[model samples]
Target chain A: MWRGLQVREQSLLSLLLPGLRSRGPRLQCQAAIRALTGGPGPGPGGLRGELDRFGGITVRLGQLRSADSVDPATFRTWLQGKCEQWRAEGRIAVWLHVPIFQSQFISPAASLGLRFHHAESDASLMTLWLGEGPSRLPGYATHQVGVAGQCPSFAQSNNFFVLFSGLIIQTKNAWKFPGGLSEPGEDIGDTATREVLEETGITSEFQALLSIRQQHGRPDAFGKSDLYIVCRLKPLSFRVSFCPHECLRCEWMALAALATAEEATPITRRVASLLLYGHREGFDKVDLTVRELPALHRGLSYKLYHRDLPELYEKMSAMD
Target chain B: MWRGLQVREQSLLSLLLPGLRSRGPRLQCQAAIRALTGGPGPGPGGLRGELDRFGGITVRLGQLRSADSVDPATFRTWLQGKCEQWRAEGRIAVWLHVPIFQSQFISPAASLGLRFHHAESDASLMTLWLGEGPSRLPGYATHQVGVAGQCPSFAQSNNFFVLFSGLIIQTKNAWKFPGGLSEPGEDIGDTATREVLEETGITSEFQALLSIRQQHGRPDAFGKSDLYIVCRLKPLSFRVSFCPHECLRCEWMALAALATAEEATPITRRVASLLLYGHREGFDKVDLTVRELPALHRGLSYKLYHRDLPELYEKMSAMD
Candidate 1:
C-alpha cells in the first residue's frame, strides 16, 4: 500500500509542481525581484498592491540562533537591489541609512500618515524603508491621525533595559516622550541621542543598554505594534529650543510623575515595573539596567507565564 | 566626528538601500522570502552573493535569525513557477525530490542529457538540488546511492526522535549512516522514514533521536547544508521498487564495518564513532546513552574525529 502511494505521489508531484521541486531557491529569488520591480500599482486598498502578494499585514516574531557559516554581506546586496526597485516604482517614500544601534529618531512621516518598511535582502541584511503615502485622515483633533511617540523605560535595579532621565516635552497639556526612527545601520545609543536633540533640543549621554519591549497585536493609540527597546540616558547638557511651531513647551518632569503618568502605554507600564522595583538613586546617580533580564519579558509573561488559561489554550492550540 | 559619519552613512543608505532601517519583523520574513526567490545572477568567480544591504554583513546576520518566518509553501510555489519558465526555455532536466529525514528518490526525465536548470531563486535552498542529478562518472557501480537498511535493535532504543519515527529509512552499504530527508513541513522522524523508504525501500520504526552532526555540511553525497539529525531505525517491512535506478542493490550490512569499508564516505567515518561508542546488544535490544549529547560528541574517541577535521573545514568554508 505504501509503495503504491509513494509511486502515485511521485507521479502527481511531477505533473503538479513539475520540474523544479528541488531547484526552488534560485527561482524564488527571481520571483521576489520581479514582484518588487513590478510596481505595487495604484490598487484600491493601498499597500498599493504590494501587500496583496504578502497577504497584507506585516511584522512577525523573529528567533535568535547562531549562524556560524552564513556571511551577512552576500545577503545584503540582494536586499539593496530589491529596495532600489521599490524606490524606482515609488512604492517607498524615504530610505534611512542608519546603523543598527544609535539614538532614536521619531518618524516625520508618522504624523504625515506613512508606514515604514525595513528588511534584509534575498541574501540577508538590514534595510529599512517607508511604504505608502500619507494615510488619508478624517479630521484634526487630539486623537486625529498624526505622530505617536513610542519610548519605553527600564529599571535600573534589575540589570535589564532602563529608561533615562531627561526633560519631557509638553503640548496642550499633553506630555510625550522624545523618540525617533533609527538611521540605517545606526546603533540604538545614537538613535536615542538624535531623537532627544530633535525633540527636546537636549544632548544626553547613554549610560547603559537597558531593557527591550516586544509585543504582538497589542492595541495602542497608534496601530497594533507594541514592541520597543528602552535605554538609560543622563542629561549631559540641555538648552530650551522652544520651536512653537512643533511644540508648545518643554520641561523636565519629576521622575516620580514620569513613572506614574496616567497616559502610560503598555510599554510604559512594563518600564514602570522596572523603575519602581529596580534600583535608583538621586537623579544624578540613577543607574540603568542593561543585563540580567528574565526570559519572560515579552508576551511570554502574559500568555505563557501568567496563568491565563483561556489565552494560554488559544496560544497552544494555534501551534497545534 | 562619529555623529557626522552617522548622518552621511544614513543619507547614502536612504539613497541606496531604502527600507533598510525599520524594525519590522515582516521585513525579515519578506527579505528571506526575497532571498529565496530573488534570482540574482551568479556573482564573480561563482561567488555566492553577499547579504549586506544596509549595514554590511551584520544586517544580513540579523535577518537570518528569522529564517523560519517565511512559509515553506511560498518557497515551493515560487520555485515551481521558475521551473516552468526554465522548462519552457528548455534549460532543465531531471527534478529529484530529496525530503529530509526521509530517503532521497530521483525521477529521471523522459529524455536524457537534459541540462538541469539552476534555480534563479535564493541559492540557500536549491544549492543541494543542483547536485541531485546523476552522480559524477563511475556510472552505476561508482555512484550507487541507496538508503541505509534497518536494524531490529532500534525498536528498543530510548531516543526521543526515534519514538516518532514512522517514515525514516537508512541506506545500506553506506560507509556512514545517511537516513531520509525530512518532508517540506515534517518533523525529523517523519522525514527520516519517508526518505529511507524512497531510497532504500524499508519502513523504519523510530527509536531515538541521536546526536546532531553539524561539522560537515550534509552527511550525504549532496552538498554542504546546515543540520543533519540522526535517528535509530528498526525494520518493519520492505518494498520492491526503487526510483530512477540510482541504487543497483540495497540491503542490510554489518554495522560494525561501516567505518572501514571502501565505499564509506566521510559520513561513514562519523557513523563508525556511533556504532563503537553507542550502547548496543545485537539488533533486537538496542540501547543508547540517554544523556544529552554535548555540542561535539565526546565519546567518539578523539582519533577518528580529528582525522576528518581538515576535510570538514574544507566543506564548512565552501559555503562562504
Candidate 2:
C-alpha cells in the first residue's frame, strides 16, 4: 500500500498504518521509507548494526531517492517523531547524515532541532541529542584541521636514499609510512616528528614540507574531512623500536624496493612518487609554522631533504 | 618586585594589594602587575583602547616579554578578573585574543570558562560571555572552513591570457583577487563563485584548485585564522557587474602586466604566478561535484563547464 504512494504520502500513511504505527516511530518511519524503496537496513555483512549502536542510527536521505522525490517537510515530521521516540527510549543521540547535494534538507533538519555536528565525505552529519546529558559539543578553536607527515631518509653509499615501507598491524600487517592523528595543540612539524617517533622510533628534523593530499569524506574519516600533509625528514639515528599497538615492524626499505612492493599503501606509493619527481616537477613546499595561522588547528605537512646535521653535513658538503 | 615573583604569586599579590586592588579585581590586578613591572598601561597607541571598547581588551602576554616570559596562571587570573568585572558591569561579552604560540595559556583559559572562539593569522580568539543571552555558541556543522577562488583565463593570438585582478575595499580601495568570507553553510566552490560574482560580476567556471594558504594567526584577521584557496577559472562571458561596497573595480589586464604592478597584493602576485604555472605542474584539479565528496561541505573545487543549454554548447562545438 505504501509502495505506490509518494514519499510525503508514505510518511503520513506510515504514521497512520496499523502494523507499523504500533512499532517504534523510527521503525515506522523506516518502514514507510522501505515500503517505497527496499534495501537491507542492518544485517550481517551489511551497514553494521554495531556502528548504529555505537554512533547513532544514520539516515542518508539522498541515498534513498532523488531530491525532487522527497519533500523536506515530510522528512522533518518523520525525523522529529523518530527523535521523540529515541528521547523516550533514553537513546543519547541520533545523527541524520544527509548527502551534500540535498541542501534543501539542511534547513528542514535544522528546523527539526538537529544541530550541525560534523561532516564526512559525501555526508553532512546534522545531529540531535534526545537524552539529557551535556548539550555542549567539542569545539576546536581553529576551524581548519590538518595532518602532516615525513618520509624519513638516511644517507648510504653516497646516495640519498629514502625509507621504503614501514609496517602496521592491520589484519596480518601491511606496509605504510609512520603516521598517526595529531595531538591537541601540536603543529604539523611537531606532529610529523612525534608521529614518526611513536610509530617508527625515529628522531628526525623536518627539512621541507613536500605535498598535500586533502579530501573531504573518506570511509575512515570520523565523518570529518581531513588534510594530509607529507614532508621530507633527515633521520638522526638508525635505532628502531616499533610500538606493538601502532606498528609491528619498522624496516627502512629503499624507495626503489618499496615502490615495487605490491603491499605498500596507496598514499605511500603517492608519497614515494612525490619524493622521486616532486622537486623537479613543481610541487610546492610550506614553511612549518603554526602560530601564524589561527584558523587552521590540525594538518599534516610533509618535508623535503633540505640538509643534514652540521658535522655530517659539513663532511658531506665538502664531498659534494 | 613582581618581575622577580612567580606568576602564581603575582596573581595572589594582585588580589591582596590595597591601592592597586581598589578598582575592580581585573583592573587592580593589572595595576599591581604594572606597579611591579613598570610597563605601559592603557596609554595612547599602546593596545588601542577603542578595540577594547568595541570588543574586549586583549592581553597578549607574548607582546609584553618573551614567549617564555609569562606564566599561564598569571594570565588566567588577569583574564578571569577581567571577565568577572565584565559580568559585574553587565557587559554582554568579552574576547581574549591570545597569540597562537602561547599555547600554555590555552588550558588555563579553558579552565576559567574561556571557550574556543575563532582564530586569525597571528592570534586565536577565545571568548567568554558575561551576559545572559545564551552560553551555547554557533557551531558550523562542517569542521573545516576555507576559500577557493578562480583565475579565469582566455586564449588570444596564441597567447594564453588570464584576467588581471579585481579590487576590494578594506579601509581603502586595494588591488585584490575576488574573494570573501564563506557564508554560513556555503561550500567553498559556491563561496568562490559567489565571491567572484559579487566582487567582479564575472561569471566563470572553476578550472582547478591552484593553491592553499592556511595560517592560524594574521595581523588583519581580526584574531581569527583563515585559509585562502586559489583556483584557476575559465571565463564564459565578458560582461561584468561590479559591487560598490565590496569591490571598487574589476579589470582584465594582461597577466604579464599585472605581475609587475607594484601595488598588487603579494597574494595577488602569488596567485597570478600560480595561474601561469599551475596547469603544467602537479597542481591538482578539483572536480566541482559536491555530491561526490561527502566529508567536504566547503572547499575550493573547480566548476566543470556546466553548459547552460545543450543548443548553445552544441552550436559552439559545430562552429569549432
Candidate lDDT scores, in order, read: 0.33, 0.48
Q: What CAPRI grade goes to candidate 1?
A: incorrect
Give, for candidate 1 chain B, the lowest lDDT window spanning 10 residues.
Answer: B101-110
Question: A96-154, model 2: which lDDT tens digit per residue?
Answer: 65554554565666666666553432344566666566652322222334444555354
What TM-score do all the candidates reach, one by one?
Answer: 0.23, 0.42
Expressed as tens digits, the lDDT of each residue in B1-320 for candidate 1 is 33343344344444555665454464453453334333333211221223222211110112222324433344343444334323333332223221211110011110122221121111111121222364321100001012232332322123332321122212344333435433222334555566667666666665544333222112232222223345556657744344333455544444444434556543343333343334432311112111111111233211000011123222322221
- Candidate 1: residue A253 lDDT (0-100): 45
List the candidate 1 regions with Cα displacement exceeding 4 Å. Answer: A1-166, A171-174, A217-226, A242-246, A263-320, B1-320
Candidate 2 residue lDDT tens string, B1-320: 22433354455555676454455666557565554433234321132112354334445544545545556566655556555444544555655555534544655766776654534223445566666767433222222344545554543423654444323223243466777665543545666777777677777775545445544443334223445555456666666677785665666655544444555554454455444443334333222121121122344331111111123222322211
Q: Write down the RMSD of candidate 1 (Cα, Å).
A: 28.1
* Residue B316 C-alpha lDDT in model 2: 25
Second chain TM-score, each model: 0.34, 0.42
